[model samples]
Target: MNSLFLAFIGVGMMAAGFALYSRFLGSKVYRLSAKYATPAHTMEDGVDFVPTNKYVLWGHHFTSVAGAAPIIGPAVAVIWGWVPAFLWVTLGTVFFAGMHDLGVLWASLRHRGQSIGTLSGRYIGARGRNLFLVIIFLLLLMVNTAFATVISKLLVSTPTAVIPTWGAIVVALLIGQAIYRFKWNLPAVSVVGVVSLYTLMVVGDRFPIVLPETVMGIPDRGVWIILLFTYAFAASLLPVWVLLQPRDYINGLQLFVGLIILYGSVLITHPDVVAPTFNDNVPEGTPGIFPLLFVTIACGAVSGFHGVVASGTSSKQLDKETDARFVGYFGAVGEGLLSLGTIIATTAGFKTLANWEEVYNEWSAGGVNAFISGGGSIINEGLGIPTSLSATILATMAILFAATTMDSGVRLQRMVVEEIGQIMGLKISALVATIIAVGVAFALTFSSGADGSGGMLIWPLFGTTNQLMAGLSMAIIAVILTHLRRPAWPVLIPLCFVVTVAMWAALLQLGTLWAGRNWLLLGIDVVIIIAAIWVVVESASAIMRARKAPAVAWSDADTDAPAPHHVG
Candidate 1:
């Protein structure tokens, strides 16, 4: 079949979901209203909680949650064949991810923008909240640490991407200044920011920057990792308006532009999907298609990490309560589209079934590299862009995606650290929390050796870990809905589905880790499995408590915060 069919089907399904399903969720379920003041206004600090335009906020939310996972997830999961990946990305986005992201945002908005980890205490009890925080901390640690190595490796391998990748930081800073400091018009500023970013891509393609194998006696990859974490530390310390928000907003727009190039290329070229919809012949060591497929494509489908990003940063910047549907649900849709595009690039970018088989000969094969090579080929073939430039464009896109997520990951890590401190009755300043966060990420990054590859040591567990987080976040949201006396079926159904599959996947990973004698990961996996089950039990008990107690009044539910920062 022509890849265009997959593109059209995926895009159409996601669009319909966003248009119809999201509206039902907003009106019938969430009942979002502008009257409820968001934390951005109530807790406005000109830093983390500054009120943001919904468009800008959407961009920020979209890009931060997106990261490189949407691309990497689908690109890898197509190893099971495109049909399962496509269905999960589309259906999961509409029903699973859309609701999960939007619901968590609304839950946080009503609660004064507490992280989902903190919200656990109100609904699930103190012990559950601590366990929740541990999962969140580990997940963020994995993200910040793994992504540093991912980005550093990319910088070293794709030297042409280095300039545009880092050049985006400068573009974002200028965009932030223009929008906030000078009060410039947003559209004009966006055009300037995007143009400047692409111009750097061109310059980067013309004059690539290749770091030597050693820089001041540090290996190139190690140097890049250090630089990346240092930059993340600095970015975390800045006001969101000055860096994080603008950078993410612009990168979100740029992703759309990149999507148009990719999807549009598919439209013009009309390449055949050389891979089968379902692989009848299984590759050796490939896990069963059912649970693994779900977890493998977590981000595009129904990632728990989205819950983290939604509750951690997005809720705080929401200008109005009603905008959650757009920022959270549609942000999910944007990622679904990216994942769909990745499915196409990987399955159809090759010339034939034979060529595709060569790349998909094993389960571990196909990811960002496949997306870049194949997507680049499609762009070059359709738009007549040179392959080198197309590769540069895609490489830079991947790098920027990782970089933005690293920025948010570090910041979220800081928040989690501070929350943990609060639980211990210790007052940790933001500066100190950020240092601890960055320090932890750095320690993990270099734990294995000077090459900074240790970050990926626990990466085998990320898919399950991320999905488990989503499940836990949804549990918190469902509990909140139960308290409000609203129908929580929307949240409850996905909650059960994701948690079951994630737990199953976690257990499966335990077997593999045990066989391999990887005691460290095995121990970590055992702890996560135990903690997750404990929290789920506590959440179930909390639901019973909410049911037995008096239903919370809507007005009271929305306005019950004691203080801005102390709500959690």
Candidate 2:
């Protein structure tokens, strides 16, 4: 089949899902109300809570959640077959992730922008809240470590990407300063920021920035990893407007531009699907597609992490309740599109089936390289650009995506850690909490694994945990729906599906880790399974309690007021 046809089908499905299905979800299922003053206005603090434009907020939310995981996950999962990866990205985004993201954002908005972790307490209990926070902390830690490792590895492998990657950061800092400090026009600054970053990409392609073999006696990758985490630590410590928000805004534009190039390339090149739809050349000990594919493609299809971002930062800045549909639902659709691009590039960009097989043979490393190569090939063919420069640009984009995630992940981790500290009655400063969070992530990144896989070694755990978090977020939203006497099926159905798939995948991973005697990962898997069960039980109990209690009337004032139970 023509890859362009497949790509169009996927993109068309997402567009229809956004226009029709998501609209139904917003109007019927979620019933978002503009009458209710959002926390951004009601709880405007100017630091964490501030009213914002929907378009700008959507950019922040989308880029923050659309990390390298979506790319890496689909890139890896296509090894099983493009069919499973493509189907899951298409269906999961519309049905599962969209609902989950929208529901959580709505629930958070209705609860004064409290995070999903804090909402668990109101809906489930204080114990569930603690459990939720712990799970979130660990999940964010994995995210930080994995992204740091991935970005460092990319920089080390593709030296040309190094300059553009760091150059973008510098550009982001300048953009942030210019917009906030000088009161520069955002659109103007954004265009300049995007142009500056891409110019750096072109220059870096010609004069690549290669690091020495050893930096302070550490391997180049290790040095890059350490340096990346150090940068993450500093980025986490900075205020959102100065760095996090503006940087994501710029990176979001980069992503938007990159996607246009990729999709246009696909349409122009009209490549055939060279990769097999279903391949039995499975790697030894890899889990089957049944549950693994769902977990593997978490970000594109339906990520629990999106729920985190929605409730964590996006909800706080939501200017109107009505914008949740645009910010939350469409953010998910954007991620699905990225995932679809990944599927198409990985499947069709290969020159020959044999070449594709050779790349897929070593699942982890090959998957990453194949996506870059294939994506670069398509862009080159479409734009008449040189393959090497196009590949470098794509690699630079990947590095930026990963870096953005790491930047956000470490910052989120700091918040989670501080929340945990607050729960424990510890008065740790943000700097201390951030240092602790970065320390743990750094340790985990350097930990031993086969062939020094580092974060890759525990990617399965990360994927399962991410999906489980999504399931848990859905469970919280379901409880909220039950309390409000609203239809709970929208949230409950996705919750059940994610929990089941995540649990199944987790068990398979536990066995794999045990057989390999990877005690650390084995223990982490066991704890994750236990945590999943606890969340399920807590959600069920919340539902039962809601059934017994009388339905509460919806009031805008009540939603805008701070909940007594909000610890974060």
Against the true structure, what is each candidate's TM-score? 0.98, 0.95
* Tens digit of per-residue lDDT, candidate 1, span 165-243: 9889989999999999999999999999888988899999999898888978888999999999989999998999999
RMSD of 1: 2.1
**Best-performing candidate as measured by TM-score:** 1
* Top of the candidates by lDDT: 1
Q: Which residue pairs clash in candidate 2?
A: 304-470
**10 residues in a row with least lDDT, candidate 1:** 559-568
Candidate 2's TM-score reads 0.95
Candidate 1 lDDT: 0.90
Point out where model 1 deviates above 4 Å: 556-558, 561-568
